[model samples]
Target: MKVIPTACTAALLAGTAMSSVAQGVYDDALRLDPNSYETLTVTVDGEPMAVRRYEAVYVGNPVAMSATQPARSMGPGGSPASADGQELADLLTYQKMAIYVPEASIEDQSTAMIFAVNNAGWFASELRTSVETGGEYVSTSDTDKVGAALGAGYVFVDVGTRGRGIVAADGTAAGKAPAAIVDAKAAIRFLRLNDDVLPGSAERIVITGTSGGGGLSTAVAASGNASDYFPYLAEIGAAGIDADGASSLNDDVFATIAYCPITSLGYADMAYEWLYQAQRDEQLTGVSLEASQTLRSQYPSYLESLGLVLDDGTPLTADNMTDLLMQIVTQEIQDHIDEGGSVPALGEMFEFTSRGQTVEVENTWLSVVDGQIVPFEIQDFLTFVTQTSALKSVPAFDRTANSGNEGVDGENTLFGPAAQEYSNFTPFGWNMNEVAGDGSGADDTGLKWNEFVETKEGQAIAAQVKLTDPQAFLQGNADSAPYWYIRHGMIDRDTSFAVELALYRAVAGTDGVKDVNFTLPWMTPHSGNYDVQEAYGWLASVLSDAE
Candidate 1:
């Protein structure tokens, strides 16, 4: 016989002891104490699975702005009215989250929490679906990170968020531009709301992820309770709002550890071209020299617009951009060499005539220090980078068929809804005219193009782009997390190296941000959260500082 805890017992177990009793009385008890949960034993594929279900705990009151309209209806499907003529509000859409506390007592262990979000390629609807179905709450001992965090007494929160490409059951675009970010903030708020009942220091939460997930993590750290997201948050019925029109919970996080974040969306295309155009080898596949050059030319002005300066307060201009990047790359390589790691030979196959004889040179960029190649030249390393082929066509992020032969890129899909597969997120990708009388352009389809910038839809898309970019938050426009740990791979071509550099400069250059550690791991590629030991160390330091 399975022993189930009553709602009263569960509530008491939160602060005291856990005692098991009869299971049949749970339903009546749960209705009285909605915040209570119960654990059940079930058989799945002949294996006994102990599952804890925490259901329908209202984060905040759901009410309509006016009596005429139905109470704030938002969720997977269109807010449909019930048969009895009452609006059924689905709090599960953006208001719900699951906490997986370890078996060990949390008070005896560390008080840190990990809010892990699963997202890739700037699309996240699938992850949200998994959370709603209780899929992500599986055994946490599978991975080293999860196991280690659990062993160290950290609570794991599986956050359900809405992102681009998530079409509702009613065929409406429920998850779009600001939905993902808004949902993330709401999840953080949920943790803060249950701080006393939950088993961790809500203030010491560490948000971590890779790629687009990493980007969102950075965004969450950078924009904490920024008023810009309030409208969207209200639209989805996010938790923590009081009847007096005040927020009862905070959405701010203690620290952020992002890896290979595909961020700075609006300017990523130009930055990619500026860094890789010189390396364009036509023989390689997808190499568009004309398109690359056109996009590369726009980077200088865009860099100037950011008004970004180096640590020494030097303006970041297009003229000095290449040199600056080279300096960073060189330093990373030198650091590797200093740590007793081998520096890879450059210009290995390049033959040069020395005294009327052809000689194959290796380590051409390196300088000898005490019989060892310790120092390297920036220009030579740059020459090596330039010889490589470009990753994408011109206007990589928001690729337009009219601009180049390439199809719609991932970012274009991210900007549009499921109904529209691709749309231009930036003005640079917008074509003035279309094919013949139709706005098809060279792509032979009107769907790939964007509406006029002055149009309502166009304005909305532009706003979303700004709202999603992390740079907007770092510019003092929003509240930022004090501690940050950022890492990107050296050879990752998914986005430009300059994009990550810009992020670093923003954090390092900013006044209030603290304990910023930005690094480019040698030969690491388009990934994150590698080096778990170092991350744990950073977490320790952050926790100490918080105390």
Candidate 2:
């Protein structure tokens, strides 16, 4: 069994002893009354696991409209699969976050916290999933994300995922998807449904996370299908789903915070290098560029041919990719740097060589794995060049294959793709920039492409092949309920603060979220060790703004 603060352990034993044995009937008795936090233990496949206590705290007073916490996304599929509207057999891969309101205490009258909890480098089965027993669910271990939420003065719910609990055997985010995001959305809907449960949940809500989770927060802020995930949700729910998982495209969330977020899916190339270099300055430090690039060349299917496919070529230096580059293009705005420092400048930042034609695009960090080469927005050549990827020096991970991913291994991905895919696992795709009219006895690129990607029931569509390498998703309300918060601190360590700041700018700029951007004094080094004072200050300001 798992141990608590010792103070709570004795009480549990006594409670168990008092159970009633009425006429050969077993009466419910033993109950472990959790303190503000505690650690729970259980075994899966004979291995012992522990879960820490997390809570939705009330920062006491003036209301913490800006209450926030960290969330996460980790495990196998470091550089996860890529997908989007285009029919280029894009493998479906994504990392994201969720937000929810937990019952708050009397002192909890405050702005909803957009809590973020990073997924450890996979293997967060305990917090991410619960074993349902009739009407109740048994909690699992792996609660660092939950603990971070509690430390932030807000209720913490699991980001909910058990990514292929594999570390890049050598960096990749490929494999089966984690259903954790689905569980999280359920938590959010539950907190909002049936007032009797967690009735004190705040009306205002937000999301926060890093790495894959960071990417999640960004999508959550988009204001779309996220609300539909829980259609019956009174306040806390996702919108709906389109081709992509849950849509956060048009929701009304109060705020979102993403750190070193994995933003796009269609603009990927030499991926790991692009990510690490982008945040090296703000990050405590990162893997050497040489290491990142080395891993980049490994683990990907060698593209037979890939010259930029269109005029809207993606920026590869920032090194991020996504399925909806077109949608992101519409949303891309220049970064607002107080002082023009090393902040990457678009247009002049990235370049892709194809058929001797060096095509460039704003290093807006958009890319996708196209055949052999990581394709950008702009179509360059037909046969894209490609290669495998690998890790330079395997650094010490915060998460081991077993217990520490939640602690740190997961966050490592936040810095860049894992060293797994370095073994060369290439996925394929095609460009529809031009191929005649719709295929009704026609060969329109769009028509043929769409037809190619259509799947039959449970099979991979013609335009795609499941890497089956292991990846994950919240994938829009696969079910009716879920519980989630942003994920932060790649399974390795804390980073991604820049994107979180950007999320504030996006929300505050458009909606009247009254954003607050402040850092915890000793928040890094490890992802935990939250400073309540800082959170209190920020939350207080948000409340004032809302009022």
Give the alpha carbon lDDT tens digit for every residue of 1-547 in model 2: 1101232233333442221221101001111123434444533333343433343211011011111111333333232232322231211111222223332332454535444444433222222222111212112222233333333445444343323333222223322221233333333333332122331343445555554555544544442223222222111122221112222222334455444444422223233333333332233234333334443453232111121112154421222222232223222211212222132333344343322355443444323222122334421110011111122122122111211112223222222122221111111112211122311111232333344344331122210111110011112223211222222221122232222322322332332323435232111222321333333445445645666
lDDT of the structure predicted as candidate 1: 0.59
lDDT of 1 by residue, 1-547 (tens): 0111143223333442212231211122212232465654433233444434343432342211211222221222112222333432443443355565544533533488777765555554222322222233322232245544644556666665656544444444455666667778866766665566656777877887777778888888888866566445444444554322234456778888888887888888888877765555332334356657766788889888888888788998878776777777767767877888765345354443322355443545655354354555554554444333236556667775545445445566566443454566665565521224323232333433344546655666676788778888786843588889998876566788888988888887665677789877765555555567677677777788777
Least accurate 10 contiguous residues by lDDT in model 2:
380-389
Misplaced by over 4 Å in model 1 are 1-96, 108-110, 125-143, 242-248, 281-287, 344-390, 416-419, 432-451
lDDT: worst 10-residue window of model 1: 61-70
For all predicted structures, in order, the TM-scores are 0.73, 0.37
RMSD in angstroms, candidate 1? 12.7
lDDT of all the models against the reference?
0.59, 0.29
